[model samples]
Target: MTAVRNVHERVIDAPAAAVGALLDRLSAADDPIFPTPAWPRMRLDRPLAVGADGGHGRIRYHVTAYEPGSRVRFDTPPGGGLDGYHELTVAPLGAERCRVRHVLECEVRGAGILQWGLVIRHLHDTMIEEIFDNIERAAAGGVARPVRWSPWVRLLHRLTWARPRAVGTPAEARLIRSSVDRPDYVDAYRVDLLPGLPRDPAAWTGVLRDAFPVLARDDGELLMDVNTAGLTARASILVDDRHVTLSTAVKTDSPRARAYWGVVKLVHPVMARTMLRRAHRALALAAPSAGERAQAQSPAPERS
Candidate 1:
C-alpha cells in the first residue's frame, strides 16, 4: 500500500510563543484549524494522553504523543477512512518569527481509497493552505489573502467529482463568516469582481443570477446555494465600496459529506472566476456605453 504523505512548513509573523499560544488554546471539543476541517467541531473524550480515543463525526483517532506547544500527533483507529497518523509542531525562528510545520502520513485502502482519491487530497491541500492564511492574518492582526486556485487545478476537480452525493441536508448549517471571513469553512474559494465593474455588490448580482441560480438577492449581498456531486455548499456575493468578492464555504454534515464537498472544492476557484467573467461580459453587452449604443442604432449603409 502506498502511504500518502503531506508535509508543509510555513513561516509565520509571530514568535514561537504566539504560535504555541494559538495551538494550546484549542480544547479537545474545539476543532483546531490546523490539520483538517472534516469535523465542524471536536470534543476531547478525555484528557490529552497517549491511547486516548477522540475524533469527530464518523472518523475516530487516538492520541499517540503530546508535547505542549511544540508537538502533537494523532493516529487513526484501524478501518477508519484514514489508516495512519498526522502530526503538528511549532518552532521559534527568532524574537519575532516562528515556523509551523505539519505532516500527514497515511494510506487509505478499501472503500476509503476512493474517497481519498476523489476528495480528501483536494480538501486536505485546501485546508492546509487556510491554516497558513489564518495564521498570517492572525499574526498580522488583520485581513490576509487566501489561497488562489488555478484554472487547471479547478478543471481536474470538476472532472473527478461530476456526480452528486446521496446525502440530504446536514443537521444544521449556520450562515456564518467563511474561512476568508472566518474558520467555519475548511475549504473556501474566492474570486474578485472585475476592477472596472460597478462598486456596489448588487450591481453584479443580476448578471451572476443569470449565470448561477441565485438563492437570495437583497440589499448589499446575494447568496448561491448548491448541492451537487454529493456535496452541499453556499457561495456569497459580498462587496465593499470598490470591489466585490465571491466566496464559497462548504457545509459538511459528516465525514463522508465533507469528502463530497472537498472533491468539488478543488475546482471551486475556477468556477467562481469563470462565473464572474461571464456575467461581467454579459452586463457590458446588455448595457453598452453611449457611443456604442449610438453606433448600434445608426442606420446601416446601402446594400450589404
Candidate 2:
C-alpha cells in the first residue's frame, strides 16, 4: 500500500555536529519541544536504540534505525490504523551551519485518519516550526524567537473549534478573557457537558492532577512555567460541570525578559486553550456517577 509522508526542514546556524548532538539528546526521554504546554507530553520508555519502544503519550513505537550524530527513525505498529515511520536527519554546511529535517511516512486508515486529520497535523506543523526556531536560537547563544500563527490559521482555529467571546474581563463562570494591551494574545473555548456527566469540582481537580503536569493547581492560585521562554506566569484555573475557565496574568520587570515573553505570548492562546480542552475531556471521563454524587450530597443518618 502507498504511504503518506510529511517533511519539515530548516537551516540552523549551528554546526552539523552541534545540531546533531542536540537532536540526539532530544530523541531520548527529555525533549526540548515535547514538553510544550500547548501540546501533549511525550515520554520515551528508554533511550534511543534500534528496537527500543516509545512514542508521544499513547502513540507507541519502536526504533527502526539509528546513526549517531546523523539520523534515526521509529516505526509504529499497524493495528492502530497507522503503520508508518518518522525520521530526523542533520547535514553539515561548512563548519558553522547545517540543515535539519524531519520526515513522517506511514499508511494511516480508519481511526488514525480522524486523529491525524483533526488535531495532529496542525499541531505538528506549528511545533516543527518552533523546533526549527529553537534550534537556531540555541545555536546562536540563546537569542529568542517563537512561532506565531498567521491570521488565517487563527481564524480557521476559531471558526472550526473555538468560539469568540467579547473582549473584556469576564464575569465569574464566564469565558476566560486574555485581553491585554501591551502584549497581545487571547484564546478561549467552551463546550457543553456531555450527557450523563455532572460538574463535580473535586473530581475535576483529581483528573487534572493526574492528566496534566502543566498547571500547578491549588486552592486559590495557579502557576505555569514555560522554561524555554523564561516565563513564570500566574494563571487561574476554575472548573464546574457548567463551565471551566483558565486565565492568567502577564507582567515582567526586566526589559529583556519582557521582550522575550512578548514573542512567545502570541502562541499562548493556542497553548492555553489546547491544555484546558484536554482538561475538560479528562474531567468528563472522570465525572462521578449519579449514585456517587448522591452519596456525597446526602446528609448523615440521624441517631436512633
Candidate 3:
C-alpha cells in the first residue's frame, strides 16, 4: 500500500508526565474502556498489546518505544495480516504544556489505496478528533498560571488574553459587560459526563452544579450566575433531545475568551452540547431522582 503520513498536535496545559501517563492508558488490556476507546468505535476491537515481548493477535501491537515524559509507539497488524506500526509522541514545553504527534505506516501488496485510506481515517478520528478532549481532561485540575497576554494589555501586572482590562477591581466588570472578557488565566477546558441520559434543562442544571463546585445553578432563562475568585460569571445551558450547549459569559473582554472561541470553533461546534448531554446522563446514572430515572427509561425523542 502507498505509505502516507498523519500528524496532529494539541497544546495540553499539563506536565509531560501527566500527559504521558494518560497516553499509557491506551493499551490497558484489562480495561478496554480506557483511553477513550477510539479504535473500537472505528470497528477495530482487539486490545493494544503492551510489552517488549511482541506476540500476535487480531490487532497485534508492541510498545516499540517509550520515553518517560515524551514519546510512545505501537506496531499494529498490517492489512489485517501484514506488518504495520503506529507511533505517538509527547513533548513537554515547560509551562505545564505538551505537544503530541502520531505517526503510522504499513506495507501491503495490491492494497495500497485501502490501507492508506484506513490509516488516514483512523488517525483523523483517533488523533485529531479525540486529542482535544483528552487534553482538556488532563489539564482540568492543574493550577492556572498567570496568562501571557498578546503584548497589548497596557499594564505590567495585568495580563489579558487578547485585550486590555484593569484586573484589580470588581467595578471593572462594568466596562466589559458581555460574556467576552479579560480573563486572568485563559486556557481551553472540556467538561464530559457519562453517556445515555436525558438531555433536558432540569437534568442539566444538576450537572453544572456538580461539575463547577463553587458555581450555583438556579432556574431561569438565566441559567447560572457564578461567583468565583472575586469575579461574577454568567452561564446558560440549552438542552434539546440531541445536544446541550453551555454558554459561558465572563465580564472581561480578553483574549482568553477569544482562545476558547477559537478552539471550540475549530474542534467541533457541537462539542459543548454533547458534553452537557453527557454530564446530564452521568448525573442520572450516579444519583437518579425519580423523575430523571423515569425520563432515562423513556424512549429518546425522535430526531426530527
> How do all models score by TM-score?
0.46, 0.49, 0.37
After TM-score superposition, the amount by which residue 273's alpha carbon in candidate 3 deviates from its true location, in angstroms, is 31
For 122-209, candidate 1 gives per-residue lDDT tens digits of 7567656756655555443422466665564465434432121222222121232322243235332233332233656557665344
Name the weakest run of 10 consecutive residues (lDDT summed) in model 2: 173-182
RMSD of 1: 18.9
Compared with the true structure, what per-residue lDDT tens digits does model 3 show for residues 93-134? 886667766666666556656644654344334433344443
Each candidate's number of clashing pairs is 9, 1, 12
lDDT of 2: 0.55
After superposition, the stretches of candidate 2 with alpha carbons farther than 4 Å from their true spots are: 27-30, 33-35, 142-145, 150-304
lDDT of each: 0.55, 0.55, 0.43
Q: List ranges where model 1 is wrong by over 4 Å.
A: 28-39, 47-51, 148-304
TM-score of candidate 2 to 2 decimals? 0.49
Which ranges in model 3 have alpha carbons more than 4 Å from their true place?
A: 29-58, 78-82, 118-128, 141-304
Prediction RMSDs, each to the true structure:
18.9, 21.0, 20.1
